[model samples]
Target: MNPARALIVDLPGPDLTLEEGRFLARHSFGGVCLFARNITTPERTARLVRDLRDALGHDALVATDQEGGAVLRRLDVPHPPTPMGLGALRDPEAAREAGAVAARGLLDLGINWNFAPSLDVNVNPGNPVIGERSFGSDPALVAELGVAWALGSEAAGVMSAVKHFPGHGDTQVDSHLDLPTVNKSREALEACEWLPFRAAVRAGVGSVMTAHILYPALDGERPATLSPAVLTGLLRGEWGYDGVVVTDAMDMRAIADRYPGGVGAPLTLTAGADAVLVCGHGELTPHAEHLNAVERALRDGTLAEDRLQEALTRLASAARRFPGTPRPYTAAERERDGAQVRAWARASVTRVGQVPRLSPDAEVLLLTPDQPGVGGPYGDSLGGDELAATLRAYFPRLRHANYSPTDARAARALLDEFPGAPALLATPTRWNLTPVQKELAGLLPARGGIHLALWNPEHARALPLPALVSYGFRPAHLAAVAQALITGEAPGVLPLAAPEVV
Candidate 1:
């Protein structure tokens, strides 16, 4: 295998380095997975993508993680409610629109492949990586929403890779950190976690990304990324997933921690993965090593010729299928799409109890998470910025106090200053509150306004207050929550299942 054509690596910055440019030329590794560092502005991004395509040809697989709401490489793009948030809406139109909007934005930046519509059913609240990233806990809901999102994205001229195949939702441990074992039988897998993948396959998803987690029921020792039983037997043999099978970042600890020095290359390819995402994190050394390992195995007869040919054929087929192109939305289309997203946000923000009615001049205290510059669910850049500005716009006399949820004393002090004054408190997460935050929530006064749970709706049930779930952290999401609180017209049901606390 040619290292240049075989590897999908990352550049050091927005502009390609001399080595990167030379390496990414035709017959080389032109497949570049973008990250935050590679993005600057729309013009710069389009230019960069154009340059790469010019060098690598139109079929070059240029990608980025533009999964709406948080996991984004380009902040300039319009991000709709996260998959979990869309799950709360459970509207196929909304889900499809969200995907289309995100894909259109990415395509404007000349990114043809979006690793999005994460199909993992979010069953484990403690799952660190795939919580809000996933659609939701329910299998049917996830399947419906995920497939809709994928189709919409594909229609927008961007290849939507429904990811973390066979599900990465139930595991508590993050595969990015270490190996997470999902101790479920094949029957159990078929019933819950695997449903979305099944739906995606049936719907003719162009690509399926393998998860890093180990399922003992499928294979004894190997994770899904390196297991033939999971990738070849189940995905290819049984389900007939003829599309490309990409491994989820071989540099991730789930693969890297076990097979040091690019050992996973031979294992992953032989296990039936069509593409190995090893070079995206900006380390070319390991990528070179992986290529060398693959070449050595091929020459030594350790890795069979049939497996290599299968992977190459799949990659070629994918290139023919997805000729990377920019699909810009018209100005009117952009505005209409934006309106649709805002409408969906309004529709998805759910109210659980009494939504406090504070006057425009009422001295209402607003307690929000102090997320500083953090992105994703923490901040849509949500914390203390968009949320404060939106709520403040509604309630001019709003007394906003930002608090670190992890630091109880700091938040407690903020509460002390408020002194039982009716306050709008928002706690954002896809899981339960931090013990400290939970304690703080309990200590709040009875009429502590409304508990606005952005991503973690269940936490509102635990707080000693009525709750409203925005199910998102985008500015529009915050605006929707404020609208609901102001007008008392919120209409959304929490997507997750469980009894509400008294």
Candidate 2:
């Protein structure tokens, strides 16, 4: 039987060391999942994947979380910003095209598998982890767009893994912090949460990743990751999902905190997961310990060897179906991809509120959140530089500022610079609105109109502003917003459940 082993390795940056690559190969890991930290340039990333395949042989799965929008892992390389931006287009055709573009980009980077096209329906607008990463609020729309993306990605020769099965969209708490429980009945879950995943499976998605959330309707005491009723019974039996079922990061608080005897990986596989992604272990020591534990379980007959072979066979079959090829993009192909990125970037713009026409020569102020210079728990490089570059291209006379505590001081400074300039708050969603920003939103009617560009809408919802606009944090959105404000054009209308706020 194939070895009961899988690996989760972090790329230092842009490429992997020969030693690191060889280590993974010698260990015979099932796969490696890439994060933003592993990417730098397209060429370098492609070379890294090539080296990994060469070292690990053709059977290894090279995967990335290239879901687009908020969950996008590669930004140093050229690609559109987020998934919500594409969802805002509300056109399945557009979503398909974007998926094709993303697939081509991933293949160019030497990645054969994508942990993307998040099937989680964004039911809770305030969900901390899934905000702009989700397609939209409606389950039907999310399923349509997500299925289109899966089909497009597969067509482009990359296997797609639909994620957070049993839904991670409705919870307010992030599973990264602790286990989140979904108290909805099976009927309610089937109607709202399970629809998108069911649609994805019907579309022939290659894989499904289990969520860490607990569903009382499925299993009262265990999270979905450890619940056979949820994974094997519900997903595999009831829904007829025969594809490989993988667990989300096993190191997440939900699994690590609750697992008995720390046998999370063994328990996960026993519960019907084909693979366990143990991310954020930091060093090889912890990873080696966990892998050893799993191996021991197999030896002791605690983890059935048949289950391990089944998982390895599915993983190998998938690798063969989507075989590795070094299709390094040429200059012409790169240029074409660049153009598509720009177009999708434009399509993602969502104008949540009306903005009155401003004079062509009117000065505009741009304010962005003060992201840490070095990335910490949330990952580094929050796209602040990219936002600034996009803004400068659109607004030639734009003035900019990083977020600060002294809102009165900052606002006064901007007022001093351009006495009549209109202010536009262009920021990634933060935990809460600054008092200055909040006061400014309230004062917009008395002064001039304030336009808010939400990189993440969950952050935007924190402030109750009437004239708020949302851009899924794509460069094209910035350009489109700037043009719409300069000219007398109505931005694309937000789909409203309630009456229009006019």
Candidate 3:
């Protein structure tokens, strides 16, 4: 097989430039993955995909990480709640609806493949990366919901890849910055990490994306992305998964920082990954180096020609399944698609502790931490102004304040000024808050108000009070929190036990 068919590259911008076009035309890249940077508008996104295909001379698979919630790349659209939120509803149908909505939106943007339905069982609450992104901590629940998502996307004619294979949910380190190790023995992995993957494979998932993590008990030296023991011996030989094996973004620090240019890409492919995904905001020249390395490996007999051919075959099969013509939708159809997302949001609210009864005439103080952006981790940061505006819809007599925990004066003033009024504090889940932020979050419980965690189910445990967790902080998540606050009702249950409960 041509080694070029084993690589997937990314564009530098929303529009295809001359250099990018030339590079794309010269290489038989198996796919091209899009990001938020490549999407200026729906029209521009569709145009870019078409342009990439035109340059490549064939319909290459176009993929995106439109997993909804915090990982949503498409902006200005209604996104379903995070997978953890869906798991909280204890309804696989909600998971399917979320997947279908994501598929419809991705298809509208000319994307054929979705890197979604993360099969990782979020067994560790401290995992910074996979927090609310996972379906839930229970392997059975994750498997059930993950399969529903994969089938839902497939129903929309979009190829689905259950990701971060072998589980990325037990480590605290983010693979984007560095490699994380899962020390579980083979038996432990089979019992926990491998459960969802097995179910996904049984459900006929089209692709499996290898995690950029090390399992010391499996292959002590190499990460799963480059370990033949993990990829070939276990995933293929033991599990009998004949579907495509795609590596996580080779540009990520776990690979790029560990192995020099062109090293990780070829190593991953040689390790049994059918496709090496190189996605980032850097130069495209590295992609050429990766392709060249694959070519050299094939010629030198370092990488078997048959293995390369097998990958090409898988890519061809995936392309055949998604012919790359995204069916257009009417405004009404788009609205209907968005309505499902909204419905999931409504049923995905989880409340902890006792629901406080507030007097209609009493003033409610909304406390949000001072952050740099408009929202916090996983999405646009909710600036002090926007946070207040969003909460005002639910609490009409609301007064907003932003405090930096580091400033003693600000903390003292914030604590003193809001004594009489009931306060609701917005906290981040994945954020390991500073001492000051922790102090502020801890102080909120004593002040007699609800602790609203905006990121994951575990954030409230950091507080000294009972908290309401939203699994996400997107518009839908925030809206759900607001609705629950206004109506004093929470329909969803916590997917994972809160830190206090444990």
Candidate 4:
């Protein structure tokens, strides 16, 4: 019963440290998960992954969150638009191509497991975390796009993990911060949240990531991550998901705040999760302490040995599916992927109301905020820089005012200064915005000539203003929104129900 071989751990830096290598060898850990801190260049990342595998003395599942939207790991890669952006394009095939591109990038970095294709049906409009990261509000669209991605990634020789199941899309709380509870009945879940997972399983997804949310209808006490009813009974027995079940990061507050040290590891595995993801941001506890807990559980007959073997078998089987060597990519392939991504961006930017055509001499007031540098549904590196530059290109007399969303005084002063001047207000709706930013969004249109540019379209219903929902914060998306605003031509049809305000 090698519990270490069933655990997936994270590195603290770009290079494979001797300590990490010794830990991997000592415990026979299943894999190493990478982050931005561990990825500097493709060449370096490939070497680091190879080094880690060498230390394990066996092929391990090298994984990373290569989900292209805001949850990007490799900074140099051409980050594709978000899942919602692809949904807006109404082309699942484009999603497949995007998945292939994302897979190729991962494979090039010697990463095998692509923890992506989030199958969560974003049913709740106010969901803080899984809003725009979801494909759309519709379950059918989410399933179609998710299955396409899984198949496409498989084709690229990279394993795909359709994530956060039973579903994390309905809750207002981020499981990273706290454990959220879902009150939906089994029938409700089947019609909405369960649809995508069922579809992905049928499509032969290599893995399913467990959510940290609790559902009283399923397991009243345990979260899905540690619930046999959800993990074994429902996912395996009912849905027949024979693939690997991964925990959403063990270090997250949802799991950590409740279960200390390695307590959650054996519990989740016993609950039917095949692999536990103990990915610390930088600092990781000693693997011996965690491995000892697992060893103790098996020794005391608390965790079944057969269950541990089953997990190891599944992990090894998934690792074997990936190519032994990372395939090389050419300039042509990169260019082709970039072109497809740009085309998708152009098709996905949804516009609402008439964007007043600004003359070169028109005084344009640009109200932009600082970029949300964090990852997830809310923020990415790609922010107002491209939009500001693009807007300035069109409007020669553009004036810039950068303020925090919470700055009411600044917002009032700016509104007073540029009253009725055609203003381009770029605001992020979902997270990190202050009360002033949210308030300013509602207050801007009444001041006139305010064309609201939503960074996150989920907030569209909340803000009753004529707006342009760009779907994402990429530079390509900025260009697409600019085109829609200038030409009044957007091919995107809302994949979900259009907001009544729009």
The candidate that achieves the highest lDDT relative to the unseen native structure? 3
Cα lDDT, model 1, residue 405: 54
Could you give the candidate ranking by lDDT, starting with the highest?
A: 3, 4, 1, 2
Instruction: Please provide TM-scores, in order, for all candidate models, with all chains considered together.
Output: 0.93, 0.90, 0.95, 0.94
lDDT per residue for candidate 2 within 1-502, as digits (tens), equals 6443444444445567776766676777777777777777776777778777777777778888777654566765456446666666678887786677677778877788888878787777557677666777788988998888887888888888887899998998788878998999989999989999999888879988889998999899889988889988888888887787878877778787776333787777878888778665345444555677788888899889887877777777888888857566567876877777766655555555445666656577766656623221235434555666676676777777665644456655765677667766655653445676676556444446555555556544445443444445444455666666666453343432232246
Which residue pairs in candidate 2 collide?
A: 6-30, 68-82, 68-83, 69-82, 69-83
How many residue pairs of model 2 clash at the backbone? 5
* Local accuracy of candidate 3 as per-residue lDDT tens digits, 363-413: 888767676332211445556567678778767788877777566355457
TM-score of 3: 0.95
Q: Which stretches of candidate 2 lie over 4 Å from their true place?
A: 6-14, 260-262, 372-389, 405-408, 416-419, 458-470, 488-502
RMSD, every candidate, angstroms: 2.6, 3.0, 2.1, 2.4
| Candidate 4 worst ten-residue window by lDDT | 374-383
> For every model in order, what is the number of clashing pairs?
3, 5, 7, 1
Total clashes for model 4: 1
Tens-digit lDDT track of model 1 for 20-53: 6666673366377888788888888888998888
Of 1 and 4, the candidate ahead on TM-score is 4
TM-score ranking from best candidate downward:
3, 4, 1, 2
Instruction: State model 4's lDDT.
Output: 0.79
Best by TM-score: 3
Off-target runs (Cα >4 Å) in candidate 3 are 359-361, 372-379, 498-502
